[model samples]
Target: MSKKLTKNKKKYRDKISHNKKYSLEKAIEIIKKTNFVKFNASVDIAICLGIDPRLPDQMVRGSIKLPNGIGKNTIVLALVDQERELEAKESGADYVGLDYIEKIKSGWTDNIDVIVATPSVMNKLSILGKILGPKGLMPNPKMDTVSTDIKKSIEEFKYGKVFFKSDRYGIIHSSVGRISFSNQHLLENIKEFMRKIIQSKPSSSKGSYIKNVCLSSTMGSGSVSLDIKNFD
Candidate 1:
């Protein structure tokens, strides 16, 4: 880190108390103030679930719509044939064509945020795995990113749809919205995500599904701990 960034981070670090876990509202307040960047930093949520991801039954992965959207008008890529290209575009998909595979092979994937692929086209994408897999942009049948309903999938992601998959450590992390959004919007997004997570709890799991929950911004070096207020 540069001396200036290091000096600035030191000043901001003192504002966030490592020992304290503020309630959701207060945590959001702190997260807003802690952002020192010139651009609007994305506000993100990270939840640690108590499910064994190793077990097929305990894996938690799904897509849900955010009430206020994920802060960005995500650019979506619909990998379909010539027939569905126009249909995909009409449904609000930014980039729609069967050329996605060729684009991937040529390293032309730059602005893509998510990809929706038809079931038939997915088999041809095996060669692009090494390029797309690590980026989490690969189409997956489980997440419904690979589907025959091209238009619906395009519209869903064009609006406010987000797909999340837990990491090896059972932590599901995603950006809820930007710092410019209202507290109500951010709070609603967080609550909606947690609600889905709870509803998706594995019946075979033995402990609390939501082991721990917190919210933090992309700017601050330290975590802005959140102690969410209990709800029924």
Candidate 2:
């Protein structure tokens, strides 16, 4: 690697190392103690939990509008069959599409954040499995994208439905962000996310599905961990 490239890699590695360990209580304490600059800025925080990956589809996907709102601009994309394209458009989606597969495969997907799609379109796009697949943008039946409810899906996506999968260690990770948000706002968002995850526990699963959760800011600081049992 070039010297500059090597330096950048080292910086990135160092950054990751610094964020690897933290406690939820510490995270909550930070939120409780820190005086946020932005009244409602959206801050990005990650939650890590142990989950079962073998039961049906392992990925959990959903959206919620943090009660305080993310305090940031969010762009939403909705893909539907020709007949339902108008519904997506009328629902106030930033971008609506009847045929977005081609564009998505062509690398045009970099412009968007959230995506909502009807069953038909989602199925057809599955053919590009290799493309949207890696980016975690592919609509999955398990995640509820294969439905005809365009308006409802779009609205939910507008709020904060996140896609999460467990890592090799059985940990699912996701981010919540708004740079200027207050501690209270961040806490509420975290609580809402935890509620959804708890509600999704499978009946067959035993013991703790969520082993633990941790929160951190995008600025790359130490993480704060939360007690999963507290939610119980």
Clashes of each: 0, 21
Model 2 Cα lDDT, one tens digit per residue, 1-232: 3565456445543444333444444465554333233354334555554456655554444544456555555577787777777787887789887566777777787667666677666556767678767776666666655567879877666666555555555565666656455556666777777787777666666775676566655433345556565566
Q: For model 2, what is the alpha-carbon lDDT of residue 189?
A: 72
Give lDDT tens digits, candidate 1, residues 110-209.
7998899998887799998999999988899877789999888888888788888788899999888899999888888888888888887888988666
lDDT for predicted candidate 2 compared with the true structure: 0.61
The positional error of residue 30 in candidate 1, measured at the CA in angstroms, is 1.0
Give me the runs in candidate 2 sitting further than 4 Å from their true place: 1-26, 29-65
Candidate 1 Cα lDDT to native: 0.82
Give the TM-score comparing model 1 with the true structure, all chains together.
Answer: 0.86
Show the colliding residue pairs in model 1: none
How far residue 116's Cα lies from its native spot in candidate 2, in Å, is 2.1
